[model samples]
Target chain A: MIDAARERIIDCDWHYQDSFKEVAAYMPEPWRTKYKHSNWDDAGVKQNLSSFFPTSTGDRQNYGKVVREHSNYPDEPEEPERVREGMDFLDIDVSLQISHLILAMGGVNADDKRVQAFTKGYVEYMLEEVLDPDDGVYGLAPMPYSDVEASLDILDRIEDEEAYVGACFVTAGASPPLGSRKYDPIYERCEDLDLPVVYHTGGSGLDEYVRAGYQEMIETHTLGFLESNMSQIVSVACQGIPEKYPDLDIVFMESGVTYIPGLISRLDEEYLKRPEEAPLLDTRPSEYITDFYFGTQPLEISARNELLELCFDMIGTDRLLYASDYPHWDFDSPSIINDLPMLDDDDRRAILAGNAEGVFGL
Target chain B: MSDGLVEVGPATEFEDGDHAIVEVGRAEVGVVRADGEFYALRNQCPHDGGPVCKGIVQRELLGEFTGTGERVEQYYGEECIISCPWHGWSFELETGTHIGDERIQLPMYDVVVEDGIVYVDTGE
Candidate 1:
C-alpha cells in the first residue's frame, strides 16, 4: 500500500534497541569483564535515560491512556526478523535505523577505550543484527563524539559498506553539543567519507533545566525536547560549522519541522546585531539551515496545511523528510503526507523519498 | 427561475477586478469579475471562516531567480488569487482552488450572465 502510492518512501527516523549486554559481547578482555558487572544507572554515572517527572504530561486529556503494547516486557523491541516482516508490510524503501541510548550513554559516558569498545560493538552488532539480513534496512553507524579519532577509525570501516547510509551524532548525554570544535575531526571524517552526519537526540540529558527530582516520565518525554534540537542547530550556525564544512549534510531528527523557521528568525535577529560573533556565516543563520534536512515524526496534524506552508516558506520542499518512528508507540504512518492538501505532487515526492536520496546519497 | 439564483442586478454593478456579496436565500456568495469573467465563491474562507470574498486579489508568484547576479521575480498566467487576510492562504478566484494545496478547494457557486444582469446559482 505504501509503495504503490509514493515513488520512493525513505523513512528517515526509525529506532533499534541495542542492550548493554549486546555491546558487552564485542568488548575486549578486561572491558568485557567490567561491562558484565557495571550498573548503567549508577549515581553520577550520567547514563541511562535522564528524567525527573515521569508523569510530566499529566495535563493532557489522554495522558493516562499512553500505553505501549508488548510481547514480553512493556517496551519489548521486536527482533530483527519480526521487524523485517513489519518493514515488508509497510514497503518502506529505506529505513534509517537510529540508535537512541546506545551511543548517547554507553560510548559518550564511557572512558576513552570504552568509547571504542561501545562504538565498534554497536556497528558490528547492528550490521549483523539489523542491516545485513534485510535489503530494505539501512544502518547509521553510532560513533562516540567523545573520542573523535576512534570514531574516525570506525567510520573508515563502515562508511564504504553499502548497507550503512550515514553516521549518527546524538547530543543527549554528551558535552558541548554537536558542532563543538572537539567533534570537528569526526565531522571532517564523515565529510571525507561522503556521509551525512545525523543529529539524533533522545532522553533528558540536560538535567540542569529539567525539573528532575519530582517530574514524571511524561515530563521528560514531553518537555525533554524543548531545547534538544534548537540548541544543537544553533550551535552549528553560531560556531560556523556549515561554513567550515560546506560539503557536510546534517539531518536533525525527532524534532518537529515547524519550529525551524521560527528558530532561524530568532537566530537571524541575533546575527544582525552580533555580526562579528559569527564572521564565517555568509548569510542569515536560517539560510545555513536550508543546507540541512529534518525528520518529521510526531507531526502536529491539527493544522497540517499551515504546517506545510511554514515548511515551504522557511525550510523549502526538499528540507522536510518523511520519518516514521516505527515500533514506537507514536510512529508516524508512511502515508502521513498523502492527505496533506497543501502538498503538490512534487512536494509529496520530495518529502517521501527524493530529499532523503539527496542527503544520504542513495 | 429565481430558485437558487441571486439577482446581482445589472452586470455594470461589478466592473473588471471588482467583487461584491450577493445574498441568495440565507447564504452569502462572493461575486468577482476578472478578465471579462464572473466568479462566485462562498464568502467564508473554509479554513478559518474569514471573509474570503473580501481578501486581496493578486497574481500567482511562480518563482524567483538571481543566479545571473541580479534578482528576477517571475509569474505565468493570470490566476485571480485572493489571499485570506487572517492566515494569508491564497485561493484562485476562478476555480475556488487554493494556490498551494489542491485538496482544500473552496465552495464555488455557478454564476451565469443573461442579457445584462448577473445571476449567481448559490445552490442553497
Candidate 2:
C-alpha cells in the first residue's frame, strides 16, 4: 500500500549523532581530557553496555554479544550502513537528518571556537559523505545561535548544497526567545536562503530550565520538545517573525502534533488582543501557522483523526509531513500510519508525500 | 429566541452555577446557563481537546470601546465563560466565541425549552 507513495515520502525529522570519538575530536583540550576520557572509550563503551544489559551478556562472545544484545545502533545509528538498515526497517523513502548538539541545543557560541569547529566539521562531513551519497537522505545544517553573523556566513556557504535542505535550531531553553531581535539576522538568512528552521528534542545546556532528578529520558525528551516548540510558535507569532519573513518556513521536529491545536488557538487569541503590535501581518496567527510544517512519528493514533482534522482545517493539507524517527526507541513502522482508522485516501496521501513535496520543494 | 428548538435537557438539570455535558448523537455538547439564557456548544475545547463542560466558569476583562469613540481599551465581562482544564482556552458560553480571539468560533448547537425540558440540536 505504501509502495505508491514510497518515492514521494520524505521523513523530515530523523536525527544522527556522530561517534563519541568523532565528536570528541572537536572538543576543547580540557573538556577532551575530562569528559571524553572519563565517560567514553573502548573500555567505557563495554562497561556501559554491561551495566545496561547485564543479564543478556552472560554466555556469548564479549564483543559479539555486546554488539548484538546491548547495542543502541538499533536505537541510534551513526554509520551509513546502519542508517540504511534503519530506513529499510521503517520503510522510509528519504530522511532529513539533524544532530542533537551540533545544531546548538547547548546554545550557539561564536567565541567558542570548539563549537564552531565541531559544527562546521560535522556539517561538511554529513553533507559530503553521508547524505549526498544517498538520494534518500538529506541534511539540516547547524546554526550557531550564539553568533548569528557567523551562522549566516556558514549558511551562505552551505545554501547551494543539494544535500542541505534547512537549518536546525535548538528550541528548548533558547535565550531571548526565537522571535527576539537577537535572532533577526538568522531569520533574515533563512528568509533569503528559503531554508526552513528545524527544532529537535534533546541535547545539552537545557538543564537550567528542566527540573532536577528527572531520570526518565522519555519524559524529559517529550516535555522538552513540546514545551520548547510551543514557546517558539508563540514567540514567533507574537513577535511577527512570520509576518516579517513571509516566505521563511519552520519545522517542529520530534515534537508531537497533539499540542498544536491549543498553541494555534492561543496565539490567535493573543493576536486579537494585540493587533497594534503585529501591524505587518494581514491575517490572524492561525493563518500564518498554515505556512509552517510539522513532522509526526510514533504516530499518535488515539487522537490522530481529530488532530489531523484540526491542523488541516487551520493549515490546509500542505503543512503536515510524514516522518519515522528511524532507529529511535519508539520508532514508528511505516505501515502503522497506514492503519490509522477513518482517514481518507487524500488525507493519507497528503500526510505521506504531497505535503512533503511542497515543504522541501521536491 | 428564534424557532431553533431541540430537546436539550430538564430546565432544572442545568443550574445557574453548574453545566451539563449532553450527548446529542455523536457530538458531545456543553450546556450552560447565564444571564437568564441557556447556551449550548460543542463540548470539545479548541485547546488540546479539553472537556469544556468540566472547566471552571469565570469572568474576564476584555478590551472595551474607549471614550474617544475609537473602540480603544475594549474591556467587557463575559459571565459564565468556560476555561479549558488543559491549557485555559476560554469561550463565552453565550456566543461560542473564543474569549479573546473573535475570529475562531466553536460550533454552536441550537437549544429550546419545552414543558420544563430543554433540547439541543446536535447538528450532526
Candidate 3:
C-alpha cells in the first residue's frame, strides 16, 4: 500500500559493523594479542542485536546484559544479511549506512599509519561488499581523524567511487569544530567536492564518562548520543563553520529534531550580543543554520503540539529530512508520522518523503 | 467550532516572499512563502511571548551536498523571523520554537490556497 511512498523513503541514518575476523586481520600485532585474548568474536555482535530487540519478557530484563558482558570487548562483526533484512522489513528505498567502529576514527592518532590502514580496510569492505550489489544501500566513508591530511586524501580517492555518498565524523573527538582553521582544508575539500559531512551520535569511547565514575551501560549509551551531538552542533556554530565555509553541508544523525529550533535561536542571539566572537558571520546564526540539513528519527512526539509546530515553523519544511534509525531500539519509520495528530497531509508527506528527496537529491 | 474556515486574504495578495498575519479566534497565525510553497505557524514566539507574525521574512542560505562528493555548499530558502521588537529574540517563522531552547516550542497552524484566496484553520 505504501509502495509509492516506500520507494521515496530514503533512510538518512543507518549503521554497519566489521566482522570479528576482519577487524582481527587488521589489528597490529600487539593489539591482535589483546583482541584474541579477550575472545572478541562475532557472537558478541549477534548478542548486541538480540539485546536491542529484547523479543521476550526475559530478554527485556537482560536489556543491558550484552553491553555489560562485552564491556571489555565491545567490537562487533558486520552482518550484511541482518542489515539487508532490516531494509526489507522497513521497505526502505535507500539507506545511508555509517561505519560501526568508524566513530572511533576521530580519536585515532593522526600520525599513526595503522589508523589509515584500518580506515582504508573499512571503506574498501563497505564499497566492495555491502554497497556495490545493492543499489538501495549507500556508504558514508570513514576518515582517519588522527591525520586530517590523510583523511582528505582518502576522501579524494573514494570521492568518485560508486555508492559512496558522503563522509562520517564522530560528534565528540579531539578534532576541532568544522569551522576552525585547523579543519579548513577539510571543509574546503568537502565544499569543493560537494560531499556532505555527517556527525553521528555515538563513538565517544566513554573515556570521559568512565573517568566521571559513570559505569552503567545504559546511562553511558543514552548520554553519549545526547551530549556528543549537542556539543558538536554548538561547536560548529560557535566556531563559525557556516560562515567560514558558507557551503559546507552537514547532517546531525540520530539526534532528535526538537532541540534544533531552540539551539539555533540561542546561537543567533549570542552571535548578536558578541559579534566580535563570530566576526566572520554576516547574518544571524540561524540564517546559516538553515543551510545545513538534519535527519529526524526517534521524533520526540512527547513535545507539545505548539512546540513541534514551532520547530517546523522555524526550521522550514525543506530543511528537515526524514530518517529511520533502522534496527536500533528506538527505530522510527513512516508509521510514526501517523501518530502526529497535528500534522496535516502536506506536513506529513513533507516529513515522510518530500523533504528527504530535496535533501538527498532523490 | 466556526462553521466556515476564516478567509485570511487573497492568495495573490501575499507576494512570493511575503507573509500574512490572520486572527483566528483569539490567536494570531502567520502564513509565509518559500520555494513556491506556502507554510503556516503560530504567531507567538516560544521563548518570551512576542508577536512573531510581524517578524521579518527573508531568504536564508541552507547547506547542501553537491554531486561532486567532496564539496558542500549553501542554498537559500524563505524563512520567517519573529524578532521580539523588545528583546530582539528571533524565531524561525516556519517553526514557532526559539532558536536554541529545545525545551520550548511554538504552535503551527494549517493554511490552504484556493482560487487565489488564502484560508486558515481556526480550530473551528
Candidate 4:
C-alpha cells in the first residue's frame, strides 16, 4: 500500500491512548496495588491522574464530541491493527506512537519513586504489547527526569530495543527546566546511543492555568504550549545544554512552528543585553533554536503560505518534521501539507519524512 | 422536470438531517434535507477544501454576554448548520454562509423539487 508517487512519511508525534488499568498491570507490586486502590473522587483527576493530570479547564476536545458527531476516526486505545489502518489512511510509513499517560509523566505531582515506577510500567507495557517497528509502529522511552539515575536506566533498557527510536521528555510542569545540568547524564546517554530526544509538551498547565485564571480551553490551550516550550528554549539555550551536549538530537514536539520566530527573536534581544547571566552560550540564541527540530502536527494550515514559509525559512525547512496528532480535535491530514501551494515537491518531501529520517536515523 | 435542472434523485431519498453528495456536471454538490426542505451546497470547504457535506448537521451553538457581562452559551435550534469535518468550521445550511463570518461562504446551489424528483440548478 505504499504510495510510490511520494516520499516516505514519518509522523513524529502520533498519540496512542493507553489504559491506566492495563499499564498498572505492568507495574511492580506495591505501586500496582496502590494505583488500583487509590480513591481520587474528583472526576477530572480520576479520569486523567492515572496518566497525567487533566488541564485546569478539563479535557480539551469535550471528550471526543467531534469524533462522535463529525469524524469517522476510531475511538482511543485503538488496537495496533487500527493504528496501522490510520497510518495507511495518511500514507504514513513510520509513526512514533507516544503513550498519552506517559506524556503526562512530567506534569504528575507525585514522588519520584512513584513516577519512575509508573514510567517503567508504561514503557514495559509498550515494549510488550504496543511496539512493532517492523510494521512501522515505533515508540519512545518516557524519561522520568525527576530522577536522573532512573531516567538513565530507562534509556539503557531501551538502547537496544529496535522499536524505541527516541526518548521523550514530557515538558509540562518540568521543574528546573530541561537545560539544568542535573539532566546531563540522561543527555549524555542519549548522545552516546545516538538516540534523539523529543520534548513533547501538553496543555495541562494545571497550576499555571489556575493561577492565570484561564477559564476556558481556548485561553489555556493557546498559551500553555507556547509558554512551556518558550521557557524550555530559554532554559536550554541559556543554560548551554545544546552547547554542552553538542550531539544530542533535540526535538520540540506538539507546538506549531509560528512560535519559533517570535521566541528566538526575543531570546536574542535579551541575550544581547545580559550575556553575563548566560556565560555558557558561545553564539546567538537564534542559532541554537534553529538547530532543534520541531514537530508540525497541528501544523498551522490556516496561515497563508508566505507566512508559514517565513517561519520555515527562519528554522530552515529541513528542521521541520510532519506530525499528525491524529484522533484529536485539530488533527491535520497529509493533504494539508500535500496541497499547500507554497511547498514544491522537495519542500513537501523534506517536511513530510526526509527531516525525520535523518533526525531519528530511520 | 426541467432541461437545465440536474437530476439528483427522488425527493424521498433524503430524510431530515440526511445528505447526499452528487456529481453535477463539473461541480460536486451536497444536497441535504433539513426540516422538510432541500439545501444544496458545494461539497468543498472554502476553509480547507474539506468535504463539508459529509460533516455533522446540527443546531448552531450561540454565545451571548449577560447583563453582568458574563458569557452564556446555547444552541440555537432555529438554524441548522453543517460543520466542515476537517476543522469544524460551521456554515449555515440554507445560505452556506459561515456562522462566525459572513465573508466566508460555501458556494450554494438552487434546489427545486418537481414531480417527486429532486433537481439541483448547478448553474453549470
Candidate 5:
C-alpha cells in the first residue's frame, strides 16, 4: 500500500558495493567452486576476467578523484545499516538498490554458464541480505542477457516477491543491444509481470569506448554512458519495442539531461529523411523516447536556470524520476531539485517522488 | 532613450568581438558588438549557468561532405557565435538561440544608442 502519511522521496537509483565472496556462496555448483579457487583479488583477474569493462588502472583512479570534486557524497556503505543511515541523511524514504558489482554483468567476458551463475548468485544475495521492503529498500533482478530461458525463470521466481520491483538491463558492453529479437522474450515477460526495465549504464563494462583505446576514465565515463544509451535508444526505436510491449516501463539511468536534446533531435531528423529504413516506427523517434522515463542522478546543473528549464519542457516534468545514486562519487542531493530556480512546488514534488511512485507502482 | 532604458556606456566603448555586462533593473544584460553589429543577450547561458557573454565571440564552424561518405571539407562560416566558457555551447549572436537547437535561447533585450551613450531596455 502507498504510504500517505508523509511526502514521498523515492530515490530510484541507490547502490552499495557487492560482496563477491558472499555472493559466491549463493552460486550454483561448479562455478561456485571455480570462483572460490580463482584469485579474485588479483588485479589482472579482476580487470580482465571478472569485470565486464576493462578500465585503465591509473585513469580509473583519476576518474574517482575528478568526480569527487563536484560533491561531498559519502563513500559506499558495505552494510545495510550504513546504507539506511546515508539514505536518512539525504531524506530519501525509499531507495531502489542497483548493485555496483552486478552492473558489470553487461561486459563480463565469461561464457553463458558463468554469467548465469553470477546473475543467479547476485539476485539471491540481494534478496536474502539487502532488500527490506518494510524499510523501503528494494532491488532489480539482474537479467542474464546470455540466456533467455534463465532470464524468464528469474523473473518468474521474483514475480510474487514484493522486493524485486524491476528487472535490470545493463547496457554497457551488451552485444546485439536490448532491442534485438533474442531479448524480446524477456521484455514480454517483464510486461506481463508488471516489472519495469531499468537500463543502468556503467563505466567498467566492456564497451565500444574502452575498445576504442580511451586510456582515461574521464574520456570513458563521459562518452560511455551517453553513447551506449544513444545506441540502445536508437536500436529500441527502430526495432519497435514500444509497439511490441506497450506496457513495459522503460527507464534509462545515470546519463544527464544534455544528451537527451541532441540525441532526440538527431533521431527525429534522421527518421524524417529516411522513414523507409525504420518502417516499424509510426512517428518520429523523438516521440518514442519522450514516452520513456529517465533517472535524474548527477543532474547537470549550471548557473543559467532557463537552459535546464528548456530541457525540462522538452522531456516533460512527469517523465523524470529523481535518483540520488547515493554513496557514489557524484551523487545528487534532494536539494538539487529543491534549489532549482525554475521548478515550482508542483514540479519539485513530481520529480522528487511522485513520478517514481507511479513508475515503480510502489 | 526612456525612463526604463538603463544607460550602459558610450557606443564607442564596444568594438567588434567585444562585450560589456551591465545591470539593467534586477537582471544582468550583456551588450555585445559582434561582426560590426550590436546585440543584447542575458549574461547567463541557457545550457548551463555559464557567463556566456564573458566568453569568446567568433565565427561559427562549417563542414561539407564530398563523394559517397569519403572526403570532407571544413571551414568557418560568416555567422558569429558566442561560446560559453564553461562547456563551449555556442549561441548565435544575431538571434541569441543555441546553434544546435533553436528552441533554447538567452533572454534577449533591446539595445538603443542615442546621443552617444548606449542603453539596454531591460523592460523593468
Candidate 6:
C-alpha cells in the first residue's frame, strides 16, 4: 500500500535492528549465553530518554512530532512489515540496512569473539527475516572491528550474497584509523568483492557522546552522530584510505550533508600546512571525498538557500545519496525531497536514485 | 636559454619503478625509471602546490567500479603513476597527466639518456 510516492527513490540509510535475543538464535556459544542475560531496556541501553530532555528543548515545539506521528517508529525499527508500511507511506523503493544492536552493542568493551558473535547473530537473522524475504531490501553486514579474522570470516560468508550491499562500522573506539595497515586486508577484500565500506555515527556500543560536555539527551543526540562521521572522514582522508585501496568506495551515513564541505576544506588546509603528517595522500584532501558518498538524512533545511546549494556544489550532486534514517525519531521522509527547491531535476534525480545506483550497483 | 643538463644518476641507479629528484636549473625535477625508460616532471603539483616529486610511484591501477552489475578490474597499460604525498592526486609519470582529469597535469620535463646516464632538460 505505497502512497503516491516515487517508486525510484532509494532510502540510502535505514535500520532493521533486531534485539539480542533475535541475534542470539544464530549466534554460537558464549555470545548466545551473553544475550540470554542481556537487558536492552536497562538504563545503559536507553536512547533519547532523559529526565530533563523534554524540559530542556520544549521551545522547539515540533520536536519529536514526526516520530509521534508514526506510532511504529523507534520501537518497531527492526520489524520488517512495520518498516514496509513506512516505506510505502514515503514511497521509498530500496531501503539499505545498517544496524546498531549487533556488533557495536558491545562497543569498546566486548572482546573480539563476543563482538563477532553479536555480528554473526545479527546478520544471520537479517538473512532469514528481512533481506531474503524482501526484494527491495538490501543490507550492509555489521562488522566486528575488534578482531580482523572475525570480520574477514563474516565477509567470506557474505561475499556471494546479492542482498549484502557492503559492510558497516562506526569508527573503532581505540583501533587504528580506518586507513591503517591493520585494516588493509579488509579493504583488499572489499576491493575484490566490489562492496563499499559504510560508516555511520553512534555505533560501536560506546555512545561516548555524553562525555562531550552535553548533559541533556537532546544536546548529545544532536551532535553525537555528527562527531562520529566527522572524525572518521578526517581519519581516512588524511591517513590515505583512498590511495591505499583505490578500488574501495566508502559511504558515510545519517550524518547530515552540511559537515562535509567544512571537513574537506579544513583537511585541504591542514595538508597544505603539514604535508609530512599525511604522506599517504596522493591528492588534495578534498579529492578523496569525491571517491566517497555522503548520506542525506535528517537532511539540512534552512532559509539559507545559497549555503545549502554551496554544499551541494562542493560535494557534487553525484556524490550525495538520499537517505531517510527511517524508523528513527528524526526520520526524514521521501516527500521532503520535493521541498528542496534549490535543486534541479537532474540533481534531484541523482540524489534520489542515480547516486545510489552507482554507489551500491543497485 | 638552455637549462643545460641535470645529471640524474647512472642508469643503474634507477631500476624499474625507481625514482630520484635532481636539481635542474632553478627547479628540482623528479626523474623516474619505469619500464626501462627514464621520465621527468617538475616537482611542483598544480593542485594545491604540493611537492609532487616526493610522492609514491606505482603501476597504474585498474580498479573496481559499478558496470553491468559486476565489478571490473583491468589496467590501461604498464604506465607508472606518481601520487602526491600530501593528498592522493595521481599523475601518470610518463605524461604528467592525472588519471582522472587529463587537463589537470604536472608540467612535464624532457628526459634524455646518453651512454649510461640519465639527464633531464629542465629548460630554465
Provide DockQ values for all models, in the order shown.
Answer: 0.01, 0.01, 0.01, 0.35, 0.03, 0.01
Candidate 1 residue-wise lDDT, B4-118, digit = tens:
6777778887777678887766667788887778888888777545567766666666767858976566666567777654335678887889888988898888988889988
Residue A38, candidate 6: C-alpha displacement in angstroms? 4.4
Candidate 2 residue lDDT tens string, A1-362: 34534445667767664544555544446645553675443322222332455432122122221121112442343666556666655556777877644533354434546555556666766765578435678888877676777678779878788788888887765777787878988888888888888765543433333665553334555565578778877777778888788788877766666677778888778789987887767888777766778777645654548665665566555677777665344444445446555456676677777777676765
Model 6 quality (TM-score): 0.67
Instruction: Give a tens-digit lDDT track for model 3, residues A1-362.
Output: 23334345677777665654556554456544555565545633443432455332222112321221111223445556666676666666678787666655555554547566667666766766677425678878776654688788878878777577777777756456445577667777877777877777764454344246553445665566666787778777777787777666777787677878778877878888997887777878788776677777757765788887787777776666677765444556665664567667676667666766665555
Q: Give stretches of model 4 more than 4 Å off.
A: A1-5, A36-59, A62-65, A68-76, A206-212, B1-13, B66-77
Evaluation by DockQ, superior candidate among 5 and 6: 5
| The 10-residue segment with the lowest total lDDT in model 1 chain A | A65-74
Candidate topping lDDT: 4
lDDT score at residue A302, model 5, on the 0-100 scale = 54
Candidate ordering by TM-score (highest first): 4, 5, 6, 1, 3, 2
Task: Name the weakest run of 10 consecutive residues (lDDT summed) in model 3 chain A.
Answer: A64-73
Q: How accurate is candidate 1 locally (lDDT)?
A: 0.70
DockQ metric, candidate 2: 0.01
Tell me the TM-score of each prediction against the true structure: 0.66, 0.62, 0.63, 0.89, 0.69, 0.67
Reference-based lDDT, residue A277, model 1: 89
Model 6 is docked with a DockQ of 0.01
Scored by TM-score, the top model is: 4
In model 1, which runs have C-alpha deviations exceeding 4 angstroms?
A1-6, A37-74, A103-115, A206-219, B1-124
lDDT of 3: 0.64
Which numbered prediction scores highest in DockQ against the true structure? Answer: 4
Question: Candidate 6 on A239-324: residue-level lDDT in tens?
Answer: 88788788898998887888888888888998899989989887788988866888887777642778878888898888888897
Candidate 5 falls in which docking quality class? Answer: incorrect
Models ranked on lDDT = 4, 5, 6, 1, 2, 3
TM-score of candidate 3 against the unseen true structure: 0.63
Q: What would the per-residue lDDT of candidate 1 be over residues A1-362, giving only the tens digit for each residue?
A: 22434467888877765566656677665767787687542312222233354433322212222232221112443366655565565557778887644534522443348767767876887777778524678888887667787788889879668878888877555667776889888888888888988887665443333445533345555555646777888988788888888898888887667777778888999999998988888878888887788888766565557765776667877788888766454566666665566778778888888899888876
